[model samples]
Target: MSGALAVIGLGPGSPQTLTPEAAAALDRADALYGYGPYLDRVPAKSGQTRHASDNREEGSRAAAALRHAAQGAKVAMVSGGDPGVFAMAAAVCEQIDRGDAAWRSLDVSVVPGVTAMLAVAARVGAPLGHDFCAISLSDNLKPWGVVERRLDAAAGAGFVIALYNPISRARPWQLGKAFERLRQHLPASTPVVFGRAVGRPDEKIGIYSLDAVDPSAADMATLIIIGSPLTRVIERPGRSPLVYTPRFVEGGH
Candidate 1:
């Protein structure tokens, strides 16, 4: 009997952000696999075996889930945010596409959840209300040249940019370089948001201008949003400033 594989997202470490479908998939899973910290967020259930691996071993972890499904175990591959966005779903799909005929026979599905970028955007105001683009600043998977070129294009296109995997212990300088790239196209006063651990207890969010922005505030867990030329920030008397990109461009359209 062929079993099933469900690629699920837990959504930014908050149980409240988990989608009903993702929760249901987890409830049905006989086995779960993901990065150690992300897997730790999953609620333990009777008869469910949890497999944890390093965050960098996404492909191997996905393959483990596939193996479990092949052995007639309902497997759930969990990611912190939406799996399709820089997570296990792409790894699982890559596995399926890589000449695995047995994987074709398995019942495979993706249960979507709130992505970190969107969660971070909401935590502030609607900075993505207009045209926007998301990119990962990590050069481990790709070259720094490619990341720079993409940043240049996004900046030239006037897109509000959401940056993921901004900084890590091994590669801390990339975020600063990305900011420099944006400085060429955007004004020094461009609004930038640093949302750290959006839904977690240690969550911290700050808004700054491109001139005053500090890339050092970012870590791997941070989601950085660089506003477009049209983005606006409305300050309140005794509350956080509201940051938003208008739905329409300047002038009557």
Candidate 2:
């Protein structure tokens, strides 16, 4: 409970998704910072300073939280999904490495939480039970050329792709280009899933063929899961459909 900073994962939104460790860390924090919308999911309590942001300037907020911790405050940075999966934990670490003396003075830790990909995969049964990979379609930090290369490689590797930051208002066409690159290595009939605002209210989960998905339908909050050619989506008679990519067959006929 000493003055330290921790990047806490609150999970997709459900209290059930929150790990006991993350809950305990949050309970011990004197202050918390997170995206504005995620703040509503956390109940307010006296003496707990909550800093909300528009989610764009996560770096600056994380830097400030580090400062608070250095000043003897138990600062916990909260993320909607897992912190290291395109979230604030890495940002804080980056700032610390870049000579933020205050941040270096404090003990920092990243607590894992349920990410969108995991939540989506769980909702769909197990689309990513086999070998998989993740990428961010946004070119904010990395160039499109680099992103394209990685996408193509992942596709050819037959890895289930969990695409983060797939689309946003400013970069609406990024996902389209990424899918195009991937298409070169994957079949059109491959199973694909779009999980919008996953684990939160207004969450929309859809499974379809890769060729049938429209990138325009995706938004910044959406997480896309494009499966390998071996993947399939099955509709059940009385339950929610399931997604799976067969790993192996016991017998070859």
Candidate 3:
């Protein structure tokens, strides 16, 4: 009998943001596989076997989880944010497509949860209220030229861009370069939001103009939103500023 596998999203970093479906999936899992830090978010359950691996070992982790499920173990593959959004769901699907035939026969499901961009947008205002696209700055999988081209295209097309994997120790210069590319299309006064660790205790959110925004203020944990030309900011006397992109475009219905 083939067992089941669930690719689960843990939400941003707070238990409150975790969806009930994701929670139930976790409860049903007999074995869990994920990156070390992501695995640490789950409350320890007695008798549940936890398989932790490095963040860079997504393929190995997915394969291991599938192997266990093929042996009749109910497995859960965990990822921070929504599994389908640049997370483990794609990795798991890739493994099933290329791995052992038995892996294809096992039952597989993906449980969705809040992604980082959504959480960050909620903390301030709806920067994603208008048409938007997400792009990861990490060039590990794709060439850096591809990332730059996409950035230019997205900016020229007037879409609010949410940047993931903005910067890391190994990728210190990409975010700065991305900013330069965007500056070519967006105005100097375009709103830029730096939302770091949203839903976490040490969360920080800042708003700046594209010309004055500093790429060094960001890291891998940060989600950066570059507003479209139509995006706006409303200031209050003694409260945090509200930033949002209007839902309607002037010439569109």
For candidate 3, the 10 contiguous residues with the lowest summed lDDT are 195-204
Clashing pairs in 3: none
Question: For candidate 1, lDDT tens digit of each residue in 3-72?
Answer: 9999998999888999888888999999999899988898789999989999888888888889889999
Q: Report the Cα lDDT for residue 120, model 2.
A: 84
TM-score of each: 0.98, 0.93, 0.99
Model 1: worst 10 consecutive residues (lDDT sum): 95-104
TM-score, ranked from best to worst: 3, 1, 2
Q: Which candidate achieves the best lDDT against the true structure?
A: 3
Superior by TM-score: candidate 2 or candidate 3: 3
For each candidate, how many residue pairs have backbone atoms clashing (under 3 Å)? 0, 0, 0
Q: Which candidate model has the greater TM-score, 1 or 3?
A: 3
Task: Give the Cα RMSD of candidate 3.
Answer: 0.7
Candidate 3 residue lDDT tens string, 128-239: 9999999999998899999999999999999999999999999999999999989999999999999998888889999999999999999889999999999999998999
In candidate 3 the C-alpha lDDT for residue 21 amounts to: 96
Candidate 2 — which residues are off by over 4 angstroms?
249-253
